[model samples]
Target: MSLASQRAGLSRLPLRAAAFVVLTCVAILGVSGWREWAARDAVLKGAETEMANVARSLTQHAEDSLDLLDSGVVGVVSRLEMDGTGPSTIAKLGKVLEARKTAVARIHSLAIIDDQGNWLTSPGTIASTLSDDTFFRHHQLSPKRDAYVGHPVKSVLDGQSVVTLSRRFNKPDGSFGGVVLATISAGYLSHFYEQFEIGRNSSVALVHGDGLIIARNPNNERFVGRSVADAPLFRDPSLQRPSGAYRFKSPLDGAQRVSFFKRSGRYPLLVLATVDQDELLAPWRAAAISRMLYVVALVMLIAIIGAVLVRQLQRGQRMAAALVEKEAHFRLLAEGSSDMVTRIGLDERLRYVSPSSNRVVGWRPNQLIGTDALAGIHPEDRPHVQAIVDAMKRGDMDEARLTYRNVHRQKSEVWLESTMRVTRKDNGTVDGVVAISRDITEQKNLETRLETLAIEDSLTGLANRRRFDERLKEEWARAYRDRSSLGLLMIDVDHFKSYNDEYGHPAGDACLRVVAKVIAAEVQRTGDLAARYGGEEFAMLLPNTDAAGCARVGERIRSAVHDAGLVHASNPAACVTLSVGGAACRPAFERTAGTDSLVEAADQALYAAKDGGRDRLMMSGEVTTLLPKASGQ
Candidate 1:
């Protein structure tokens, strides 16, 4: 019965072992290849997030620079229009301009140019007709009244590359009197981008909405002021989005890149943060190759181990010890990995845990074995984690990855991420589950910080315009749903330009900071938000507030600033004061309804307060206000 049959079975072992080795290699290749793809996706997403962060930071820098220029130019224009165009007035203004240029290092030049090709500050530029200048023509012809930013040009006085930011003033008779011109060094602005640590071949740029490159990092002087109108960033679909990210091949160097672009809120400007795709993926590519090589070695090791097991089976007595040795060999493989590995039984108890648990989660492998698998996870995250495990046990899923929090450890939060797979018996029925986990607290903290930076203003440490816009939209929807009142206060520092003019920009900054603190201290409600709206302007948004209540809050903020007693020589009150205007309304839900009317009304009242002597509060709405009725009432 035995000799021939045993001989045939022994002969078939080589073919069976070869088949098993091939199948194991195929499975390893499939799983490892999927992981490689996921790694690439993670690398690309990280680049996208980094580019977004850099773009936002550059946008803020550009905004602050423009604000500084606006403050100086506006102050000069106001003084010239009111003080008259006499020779004495022109002489006095010229001296003031020279002083400002000296005080602020960033200001290349500041001048008042007449309608007739004459420069009040510089006698040399008189021969060069200022009347034909792009900035001059913009102010002379366009009545838009906002500050105008012209293309970069070589300064006539010194041949330095400069960008002109100008505003026009009118005579009391409504005649075009002259233009206030301020130039800032384009090099200074572009150089600000060099501090970022983006890869070598990567670049950053500031582009006009009309597709002009105002400045660029990794700078070439020849590239400044060049038009990139046909670049992917300025193309049709890209232009349609205010801010977005995309992948494209650069026309300048033909390098593929992952780039992010954002448009500035108040200006026709955009910021581009481009990352070179090759450099971005270099580390990931190297790691991926290493991993595939490791998989190949692992497959060969498994085949050799299986052949030895078959040899032990032939001897019959050594089979039991060989199986135990194989288990230990696989354990060594798990321990060599960076993650903490664990195996769970159907009873949801840990059957085995890798030694790396001590490093990853501060728990020894022996201490975790036989314990409930979900016990260490936070209560809120346990249910979902268990659901994933159960689904895998039922063959509904073969693999899953999840991130969750751990139960309190020593006095700090711990975030953990897990990649899990279903373990099966030779009969193909699910036995239990196997998992790999690693601590991800650092990553979680970094993400939180990035989110905060996106919303908060770096200078004043207050809610920035972006945060305010997001909150405004959210509050608007809530107000509409409840038929509740939303109150808004528009606060502007009174005669701020004159203050900047008298004390210089540094003192002006300190004065604004003091006022900002005073305004912030008045809004005590969790729902009320106070934001730095823009240069010298602050806003307080009060939800469920009536016009009277909003006016009271404005009065408190005004009184606080007055009490702070920061001196402002140019202000009529002899102190820094605020012109505050409040508007409140019960929102009626409609598809097209928005906060535009409320903003407009508050703005009108703000202008009225400014015209009616500076330091006062004005409220916009009926004295007898009607409230939305509740169903019971």
Candidate 2:
């Protein structure tokens, strides 16, 4: 062949080789991309299946709980019909209601009301008549024998949100004889829903057929009883089936989510389990991006090799330098991340720490490098971090996302959420872990503050009535277990309405604050609690205290308030004086002497104190007698 022609053929050879390499690279990436997409679809499908199963399980559980509650109500109804509503029969009914309430953790209260909506038997005192309540009216109007679960409402007894399940009882003439009620706190279902770890921005909800949200995780009190009848989750024909999945935007929070829903087989209830689409696909997107980068890099490297074979050593060196530049770019991206990026070695030492460590944990890269990464973890969180690290090392977990506390340079604890992946060798041997951590201390602190606001009274800085009720129940149960006396003192500001009308609302509030402080000071035991029961009323719960002790404390509280000398021009005493009543009893599981009875007794004594004379403490008994005068009195 001629020299020019041979040279042309050789150049064409290189060109042909480059074209072939490019096509092969494209083909490989195309197949890999298809596989990755398939994998992503599989992950999503698996998640949907899992969520469906969760929805079904939760629905079944809710149905079973309701059925059990309904059975209890039915049994009570039968007994009431057989025994009638005499004092003895009411006492027996009270015992039965108490036993049911004790046995069922979810039941907040159990009561039977008369035709006039007066409670015939209750676990606690019914603070207000439920004559106008929806459930009460429903039972009075509709003679349905089925148990009806009502929308959430602030319970009349303790003022916490509760879902009431009521069954109507009939008189001999078949007229309504009021309803037997079983209340479950909406907080109970929310708390139960929190047990499942779905994902960030995920939610689980139990909704009634009428579209009232009975309970939900990420529990917002405002939304608990709200109706979502017009929402797509309820209105869409596709979602009305027994069980299904769909993508919809949440009406409550306005977030788009993949929702799985199941209708209860027994009750007019439904369970919804939702996961945010962004969160659900986040891992898959990351994996796809990583795979795409790997494919691109491999194609670039193959092209470089093909050029090197065509153009000898000089071109090969340039292409190698280009590859190095790409590596440097990746390193720059990692180091520039706001999150602390770290790679640990097989020896459990940090092989690399991103520069962001200084911003995250106030530690320099060199300070963290070559050191045990878990050593900086808070003592309480070290074990969990160690377990995750150990799992990564053992290849038991290929990826893990964990939240833990880390010790900052100032000795303050900082919460960090870390996403980590296990690195492996070509032979599939475990190498180390690569982790990215972001500080979440502020988020956690905000959550804590929000939680505090929910349970605290902004005015008196005491636990609100809701918290007080919860603590009282807990203490009552504990005291019952120990066979110890539980004392409850009810205090009311004498002529408080007149004070409010005379002093103006703000000054009246200040007077109440002083009274709250006095009560808190008098009940200073660690387990004791003082709370603003309502406007112009306060209560103190004394665990392990007897009637005499409670009376002494009550007297001290009254004396302290009288001494504070906040003038109340409208009162007979001309000062803010308290009328205190106390009752103490050993809580009994089988008898009617529960927290409610103690409260009722204290209330009766409080009324007696007001009737005898203001500014005195009274103890409940056959004949209410005044407490001995304080030293000054």
Candidate 3:
């Protein structure tokens, strides 16, 4: 234990301590790297799972959309078969197609083609024949009644790409008659796919079983009808399941992505959801690098300060973990939301828009940022929306609920119900508005359809008796207030009962519809109302008309019905004809008379016309007397 021996030992202690610290730092770095790798792998797996879920959801949506179109086509085919392909039947079919086209925004057109590919009924007259079309040929040859979804084709009418949903119709003898086709715009599918909040360079696509890209987000018109059959995704034996995930470089975009695909159970369509490999791994990589740097810093501090900094390092780690968790939670809530979350500056510009903006208005968050918040509002609704914003700015209302029309990027109108709260500073100064908006377009459309159904006749597409009564009362009041004459014409089909017996109930319905159209045509004024009063009976109310004008309109209606030339072997005229009765009056003020008197007068005139001879018009006199026959004797 001399001084030399003691000094050597003390110097060795420092070297030994440095070696031990180096080993400890290496071990810590190894463990930290391993943990980061594991976490990164888990994040990637989670991303794949999320993509799979998105793919499944999009597949189901696409299947549902196709099924809806298929069902509508089938219904039209069934209806056409039940009622033959005569002119009247074709007219009815056209009406059905028109209604379906309006109700379904995705449906570009609903058409019926004959066996020879002639357009039997369509939204508009297009001379193009479907004889060369694959869908038509498939139905013409195949006996299967399954609806066939055709590949994308440029529509001759609008030159836009469309996929056809078609059902084959057979004749009574079970022979192929024609195909009832519904064209769905490919843009609609693209718009739907754009709603998903997949990361940057991500893709959502719908492809045919044959690998034709039917529709895709980030849609390129050139690649839509192209085939990807040779691509690894389709060619890979391991990725053939009904639903699956795979990693591949996209042939179209050349970006490497982890893609999830789902095949529709009901159709030959496949939906793909994908995320770029780099994008998906970006956050985890950044977090890993940050953790690595923090670990290195911790190691340096340990070497310098021994174990004193360990507790502080642990505390920092915990705080960092908590921040990461909070960020993840925030992203989860924000991205998963279906309702759009928005921050609007006091300048009426969009400060921040959530990913859900894509779903609600078909606009990306970036596309909306810094744009005028009220720019997309419908012109008619802008004033109201501005008023609401003004109220919030004035501090009169801290929160408001507003429903307004937002013009979608596709030029369609979407109704959004927004709940907005004014964000205020501590000093009570307005900061901005925070809002949550939900798309209510479908709900609004449903309400509109219900309202239409309530007031429209299902058979003739005219006003029903209820609607007629409502309008009659309204017009009557208006005419009374203005001291103007109101005209009423009661029309009945001649020999309708016999027509039914001879031509069957369906033909009778057809005849009645035609006669109703004729009556409707005769009363073309803005305030005129023509309605199916009852079975085989129709009524027309024309405001600001005298007895002479009423008689002239009645004559026009009778002639039009006769000119329709709807064959009626039972009637003496050898065709479908209408018997008309007319009445005109200037209603007096209270306690003078009721609308019943006008109706009774018209009824009496109608009996006189029928009694004199069918197919004629008779006018009611001023004193409720029946005047001579006007015309159509």
Candidate 4:
């Protein structure tokens, strides 16, 4: 034991000591990670279980409310319909509804409009004026024994959102008379969602089947009645899931957020939940970053100590001492890293797992180390995931990304995003991949929102021009493929200019929206499209429709507009009516005939309608001479 030997031994001691400390730290991290993971897994599992229960609770509550409303409404409407549409009937029904004010008041006003565009009974004197209103036409179109629920429309009596429910009534002897009606207020239905509790920086809203935001918590006043057509949450194909979380941009603050949706089955209601991104990732991010920082600090300290120790050591003993110390330091670093650093086998199973394994999967590193990683993937997504791995093996991709739902220890589905990079040999051959994943349900939501804004219309809530264009092209292609006719109807609100002149621009805007809704309802075929072409005008594309079908649809739209009866001093054909021009033709792709031709023909016919005295439907062949015969024919 000479001086050199002592120096070598001292250096070896430090190396062994550092290695032991690093290994101990690594084991601690692995154990801590496992423990934390198990706890989080439990919490998430409980949350999922609770969510299902909550959904059931919400469903039950909503069902009770609906049933109560239905029962009360049926009694009143049945009495009103059984009696004649006389003043006595009106007085009796009004008194009955007023007596049941507690229930009826929960909604907006309740009234009965006849099939001939006349109010049979109502809340007040305003009913007399609505006698010739547009809703009457809707009642006429609705069949006997069936109810027609109009889209959200503003009540002329009160400036509020309302859904007009009407059932056609006829004498037992088979004579057509009128309809029984009920108007549901915005406040009544919106109150249901207002009671929900989402996490902080989160929101819950109710959207219509057509993708319009009818109600929302926190900002219902601002966003309610506003259309999210331009929002990615509305238009993206991926966002169509019935109940799942994705990303969205806050309409108020424009911040990216996670959004979850549950589409209502019975009612045209859609529930959405939104949450901020950073809020969800904060804990995991902090833990991962802190661990990396610790590793960096330890590496720096070890490097400095190694340099200093080498300088102090005599030359002859340095090499042997350095080798031993380095091996120990390397081992310590490997064992001490915070992440569950492991060497995977060729079979894609866990050959090694750090103590941190328990933190990630609710199982200790030892428990999972020998198991196949594929076992953790959700059964539904497993095949696709394995396919991606296989592609990676074949050098089809340098790296791959995946987000999958996995069942945790508590049996809760957790969304996970994974990034895997394949390790390669010097010969460029495939080696096992190192995959790292983190929960990113919120991130995916934001991306989904971005995609929605690109597809939907911002106003009128009908599909935007681009979306309409795409749908039109698709419909046209289908019609051509099947050798069926495609019908195009172009509608212009007659004397809209005069309506705007007599009423304010706000009134004009309101009139247009109401008209747009009427058109939407009238064109109810699954493949039909109703879109705002531009200012005061709308377009419809009907697939598999012939000339007669297009004509009937056009007449229904014309009649509905006339029924709305929004006042206009300049129009000769009653209060604000619509003039529609339609064209139906089997498409020919090789003939170079574009959609513009149909639009042009329809527009030309519309001009003829205006020239012939507005509020009529004109087909491509008919000229202004026929407008008079078509008017109220």
CA lDDT of every candidate: 0.81, 0.82, 0.82, 0.66
User: How big is the RMSD of model 4?
Assistant: 31.2
Candidate 1, lDDT over the whole model:
0.81
Worst 10 residues of 2 by lDDT: 623-632
lDDT of 1 by residue, 1-633 (tens): 233234445657665766776788789888999999999999999999999999999998888888898998899989988997788988888888888888887887778888774677666433242223888888788877799988877655565567778899888988888888887777887777889988888899888778888888876466777888887677767456878887888776688999888899988889989999999999999999999999988988987887786666556533423433436766898888888899988889998899888778777888899999989888899999989988998999989999999854353558989999987765678878899998898999999999999998777778999999889888888998898889999999998999999999999888888888888888798999989999999999999998889999999999899877888887778898999988887766333436666676777778888888878998876312311122112
lDDT of prediction 4: 0.66
- Candidate 3, run of 10 with poorest lDDT: 624-633
Better of 1 and 4 by lDDT: 1
Q: What are the per-model numbers of colliding residue pairs?
A: 0, 0, 0, 21
Clashing pairs in 1: none
Reference-based TM-score, model 2: 0.47
Regions more than 4 Å wrong, model 4: 1-56, 59-63, 103-105, 123-138, 144-149, 155-158, 171-176, 188-197, 229-242, 280-633
- Model 2 C-alpha RMSD to native: 33.0
Worst 10 residues of 4 by lDDT: 623-632
Q: Decide which is better by TM-score, 2 or 4.
A: 2
Per-residue CA lDDT of model 4 for 239-306, tens digit only, reads 77666555556766776765556665555566666655556546666776776677656666766675
RMSD of each: 32.8, 33.0, 32.4, 31.2
